[model samples]
Target chain A: MKYSPALQGLIEALRCLPGVGPKSAQRMALHLLERDREGAVELSQRLQVAVDRIGHCVQCRNLTELEVCEICADTRRDAATICVVETPADVLAVEQSGSYRGRYFVLMGHLSPIDGIGPEDLGLDRFERRVAEEGVAEVILATNPTVEGEATAYYLSDALRSRGVKVSRIAHGVPLGGELEYVDGSTLAHAFSGRRPLE
Target chain B: MKYSPALQGLIEALRCLPGVGPKSAQRMALHLLERDREGAVELSQRLQVAVDRIGHCVQCRNLTELEVCEICADTRRDAATICVVETPADVLAVEQSGSYRGRYFVLMGHLSPIDGIGPEDLGLDRFERRVAEEGVAEVILATNPTVEGEATAYYLSDALRSRGVKVSRIAHGVPLGGELEYVDGSTLAHAFSGRRPLE
Candidate 1:
């Protein structure tokens, strides 16, 4: 069916979002036009504002409207300890865990040579400069457990250790509530190999 | 983690889309900001333009930028045989099937008294007026196969029949290429009860 030009445009544009396909885009467009015109307007305005204003924090490379993010600006947080993560979402996950009291450095993405991503693309030079300037004592490598994440963590640790900075990787094993039988083989193996003796 | 004001606003606004929750909204917001700013801007512009320009077609209440939709304006299509559907998406589905040569009447939604929607909301009076004015020969009920949709179909048929207009319902049975063994009990029962004699 030939939708009116504007309607068709909206449907096609909605497809740009992750996971939204043709059918979903159609449904969303119709829903916004029919049931929630006000919501659509709000969304449009917000998208415009966000796209125009939001930029990476200079200190942590996390998304922010300001030069520095809230976490980076907060003086009470530990300046000597930095938790490195791949994306802003990872920062949220670590914050939600509520155990960490350190600052964060968001890489935005991991090392991906095939995709042409490198340390420079991830702002490793900026990170190294920050570490030196801040007199950071320890760095926590909390990049994901994926191969790319591990590679990035290893590179970061190698670079930082050469400059006399202590580095630690987050544990990779079965989740706290996960059953052993359901745990993947590699993770189970990691758990067994990394097990610590009782004091 | 506390996202910047603009980023937070975008994430919240993204949740207005159907089926998008907090996590999905966050993901979409970050993705658009990080990887697809141009797409986000295009989506925003399209959304604004659609909301500003698109309105229901006066003839059939289908969404369109013009007073009459393309299907309604076409002279070759059978205006005397109006295929009624629950939404514009259903119109697309029927159009894609390539069997129906008739124009469409989009009800936009089914009659649901609980949701405060009635014949007036479905524009049944407008449909009736159109049928009378155009000398419509047949009205095909192609609403969804749900409770509200069935109730709506029955109501439309009854209303149109009283006015001496022919009305027919699309078949409800085992779908083509679907196995009988895997078919649900209710559908199988519908197939049995709706059985037609072979020529």
Candidate 2:
């Protein structure tokens, strides 16, 4: 059941992707070799270029080719308001919503004390300096509603409040399309507690 | 919502894989860029190597770095008995079973007149020549049990019978580990008609 060396190598390499297992890796390798040679070559070249060129944005810690990310560089975006997220993917998600015109800060990961990740690991000190020096008036925490995300938001709120920046967390509640019956207890509780009066 | 040029290219290229849509492609691109840079670089290099080197086997149309595939090159297999399959993936599946010790001929696809695919497209002429010149005794039609596959099998049987070679189609029946009640009606009928008495 062993494939040729080149094919074996390709299959093994493809397994590095998240959720791709041995069977899926083999299928992908065969598919690329059999049907999409040109696309495969293009993918290879692009992968190399991305790996070599893409780096963390200096200002926001999001992935970028330049020193600062596009969001951080755009003068039209509200530099006075910074929305913080756990990963670059989250930055993309928020951008896709198109409701926010502010800049972003990617923590790359949430703090996990058991894993030895702390405020320094998430570049909170640098973020603090950016808030003060760049005259950021508001800091919005948009991290996920998990335990670590909540803990990170709490820590960042405490750390930034002394610097005179208004701190706020994104609302936690039932998702827009989610049925109330299907919504979990904690989320329902949060939604009820955070209810606002109609204007 | 636009990614950098290199990142965008990588994501688009990744979409060429089967079952990978835009969201999965984006997730894969970000995962490779953010978490597994070294693995990403290796995958890129391996993809290039595989694409540059792997080609169809001259004898069986299976993938190989050599002119002939490993199975075709092997001296221990029964060259006189050739198992014909619709795709190279089927060749791997049959090989994994370890029940057949014969050589293989990959048709690459089934006969579909509406799609303009014919016996010539499946390289049946070359296969006929191989059967006559190489002294092949048996030709096993292991194509899938689909409409096009059944038509192809019938065509091959008629064509090869005139050449005095034994042409046999693989049995169509209930699959192993399948329950009788759960099996489809056509497959159950096939199993009933093709049944043999226990020895």
Q: Pick the candidate with the highest lDDT.
A: 1
Q: For model 2, which pairs clash?
A: none
What DockQ do you compute for every candidate structure?
0.85, 0.77
Itemize residue pairs with steric clashes in candidate 1: none
In order, what are the TM-scores of chain A for the candidates? 0.98, 0.96
Two-chain complex of model 2, DockQ on C-alpha atoms against the true structure: 0.77
Candidate 2 TM-score for chain A: 0.96
Per-residue alpha-carbon lDDT of model 1 for B49-157, expressed as tens digits? Answer: 9999999889888888888888989999998899999999899889989999998899999999999999998899988878977899999999999999999999999
Poorest stretch of ten by lDDT in candidate 2 chain A: A30-39
Candidate 2 accuracy as TM-score: 0.96
Q: Quote the positional error of residue B19 for candidate 2 in Å.
A: 0.8
